[model samples]
Target: MEHSMFCYQCEQAMGGKGCTKYGVCGKSPEISNLQDLIIYQLKGIACYAKPLLEKGEHIDKEIVKFVENALFTTLTNVNFDLDFHLEMLKESQQVKETLRNKAPHGNYPEAATYNLSATKEEMIRDAVIAGVMYEVDLDPDIRSLRSTVLYGLKGISAYGHQARYIGHHSDQVDQFYFIALEAINNNNLTLEELIQMAMRAGDMSVEVMSVLDEANTTRYENPSPQKVNVNIKKGPFIIVSGHDLRDLELLLQQTEGKGINIYTHGEMLPAHGYPGLRKYKHLIGNFGSAWQNQQQEFDGIPGCILMTTNCLMKPRDTYKDRLYVTNVVGWDGIKKIELKEDNTKDFTEIIDKAIELGGFEKNEKEKEILVGFGHHETLSHADTIIKAVKDGKIRHFFVIGGCDGAKPGRNYFTEFAEKVPDDCVILTLACGKYRFNKLEFGTVAGLPRLLDIGQCNDAYSAVRIATALADAFETDVNSLPLTIVLSWYEQKAVADLLALLSLGIKGMYLGPTLPAFISPNVLQYLVDTFDIKPISTADDDLRNSLQQAN
Candidate 1:
């Protein structure tokens, strides 16, 4: 009789409503229940950790990691194993209990006092009461805002997970994780107060993303212009996917001179530009295309497939045996490449598998793609870019970026990028660039027409570029001749969108579909307040954005 696994946190929910029985992403009722319980336990950890943070006391590092992982695990299509979530949930509860007991004695919330269930049946019963859906407010508008804030936090937590991996941590960002979670539990707040809370979460996203950017650049060097080969070379190789550069680095270092080549896939394609990473000669060109096409492209692939983070789909039977995952990515039966406590991973078995498979035979018609146009590279030619703007040669800048999905309307991104006038420049990041990254967009005043900003974590770099450009022109970011047309298919996009809204950047376009979690009143509020529009036809959107810039 209880809610049968209700979830509306993403764009691909069933019928544009809650997925009440099973997730459209292939998550079952059991997995959804475990994910909900994981959140319930995370709230308790926040209850204890938040106050210690406020009083300038150190909350244990392990607790922070648990919270970050718990939230990130619930991201769409990231994990499908119920047992993994249960084990993590059990560990999360232990951490929560230890923190509650060790804290300087003060009143604890109900979340802190609650005990995790010992069995699957009891856990499901408890989740019906503890899940986010249980917080149904009398005011539909307030409920809508709270749901938005929770989704935003999920995205922030994901970014933080990646940041912490690269040794970047921010006290402010850590503190807000608890503050935002606690805010979602407070039901008495007025509608206006909830709106303010959503904006505050947005502000936190900027700080979180900045930490990730620093972590990546400091360890991997600033990205610069580099040519990436799109054609697969002959011989045994490994196709590295997802956004973890460190994982890629380890594989590249381990596979050197072993007669096995490593190729980037999806978000890893941008790694070729980092001087430190590109130095490895064996780290060859990218394989296949976007994430959505993997089921087909990876079918009977002759190399090993390793996914380092989110955006992993259900691997097809043809290649599932050869595929591997690590760093918080897990599927039901696929093998996970394990890392030691010291952060070292053993990819030797994977290497052996690649050799056994014996990759594709040589193709004489090798193709090349260009990438590595991060902030440093883009701004290296700042004078020329600025002068082009002043000379009216470059009329507009369109920031078209976000995750790629198999949704019907995603073609809008490809068409939109293709049709942008020669006088305009396109800045892109994440897998969304795959929609058109292969296309040749020649130079304008000695600058490439399209710039590949690093992975999704490099959204921080995009903001930095915009801020610097605004400063150069002596105008605010919103006042600059820039338009944001985003394609979002996951939680990270939600966090990035909030970061933009927090900056008061207005009139952005979002698609292939609006989040199912944003209720009617909340959608109306976003429209009235920020002028956020659901995308229309590619031609209409291009014309409108250009006209606005003019």
Candidate 2:
């Protein structure tokens, strides 16, 4: 084969192997090669950043920006333009050089030496020369585990970057990324070592999530239970997707009373709950379900889609012109609102486009979706929840949520949720809730049995609830009668896993396919430390989960 012309990095990769001849999602080989180079460069920068922390050097805002942009660029369905990747590489190298100059004698950790600054062609040629071709080259299980960690880190990087943008930074998270990246690149490390490293990554993720929680609540005020509309009113409108609230806030301000209505899409659904954002009458309702369903959901949808972050699929030609990208998300011919030096985005063009497109024919029927079950909102009902538990009305709590995917096994989530005992409460967030959100699980002591706790980033809500329950019962989080049955499809899930591990929340059931990235040794480490298990049949997994909780 004269060098495959396409590549695959998602769960639905063509033929169960990466697409090298043409991306199933339409990405060209040139783009794949560039993305690889970008990842390599990020690893290189991470390697460099690691030693700085050990040497007691502070990480400036620029370094954080570089790391965040690099990781965000590599997320599935984000940036697909080679030129964009080249620019990012140039920027990454510039940042690396600046950091090196500042810390000439600073510890240059081995992990930082992955040489990600090479041009795309150079990096691809080097890969060919090195003979490390694709995930198949490594041990299958190891490849899966490594990919899991990589994607998980990508998710963490996205959330971490957003938090930092809002003035929330975690030294431990930065350090953990450096250490984990270094460990992943280490050829001499044993499977046991890698597995332990994965768990450590999870532990570090806890601090990162906490930092984000503090940043979000302090900046936007904690989320409250709020019902959002799905009706599209007549006039121009903009649909904002992904999970960055800061970007959403900026767009909300820019489009304020501009006669352009705003709608939240995918993970952006939870934006309706924050006091700072909910006040906007123009913000409107959620457009669709998880990121994977956009092709069908967005088809023929009126108005423009303002992409603030990842989970962006390849756009169709019809709606392609209406899609706008900000931050690191980009595609050929797509209009992207660039962020200014102070991390501000100019959405003037997007607002104008919405006006040009106008919107749906008229004010559609109201589709009220339940959201805002974050820590603050959930805790507000603490007295009621505690009373339910004390009175034996709510006997069990099941956190059944994670990133959504196209896999057939995903239906198991709905099945499991339906099968959960009547006395059980299901706390969900992210895209996974679409599996069962439409089902009315009724109430346990006046609280809905199925709680929609914001988006995937809002997994922090589940953690907070777990900790509070533990505190109220005077026990450790692990000892509480709660079970976390998670399904992951991306990098953010990896970060969330790390957070759970860090907090010592054990006995988690993770499934819908074990990450193809985790090596057996690493998997074993998780099994031993966190007792993490993959989901089997819905009935079997549900039974096991309930038994563990009991």
- The model with the greatest lDDT is 1
Please report the candidate that would top TM-score against the real structure.
1
In the range 354-431, model 1's lDDT, one tens digit per residue, is 999988888547788788988888888888989999999999999888988886888999999999999989999989
Candidate 2 global lDDT: 0.76
- Error of model 1, residue 318, in angstroms: 1.1
Residue pairs with colliding backbones in model 1 are: none
What TM-score would candidate 2 get against the native?
A: 0.90
Which segments of candidate 2 are over 4 A away from where they belong?
5-10, 13-26, 46-49, 99-120, 127-148, 187-192, 547-550
What TM-score do all the candidates reach, one by one? 0.96, 0.90
- What lDDT score goes with residue 16 in model 2? 49
**Worst 10-residue lDDT window, candidate 1:** 129-138
Candidate 1 stretches with Cα past 4 Å from truth are: 1-3, 104-109, 136-138
1-550 per-residue lDDT for model 2 (tens digits): 2455434346556664556676655566667666666666666666666677778887786677677668778777777876787788778777767666665464454435445535556656644322225434676655555565676677778888889889888877776666666566656676657666666767666667778888888988888888887656777788899888999999999998788888898888888888989898888787767788888877866789988887878888879988998878888888888879877878878777788877877777787767888988898888888888888888889999988887688898899999998998899988888888767788878888888887787788898898898889888888877888888876787777777876777888887777544556767877987888888888897787768666
Cα error of candidate 2 at position 6, Å? 9.9
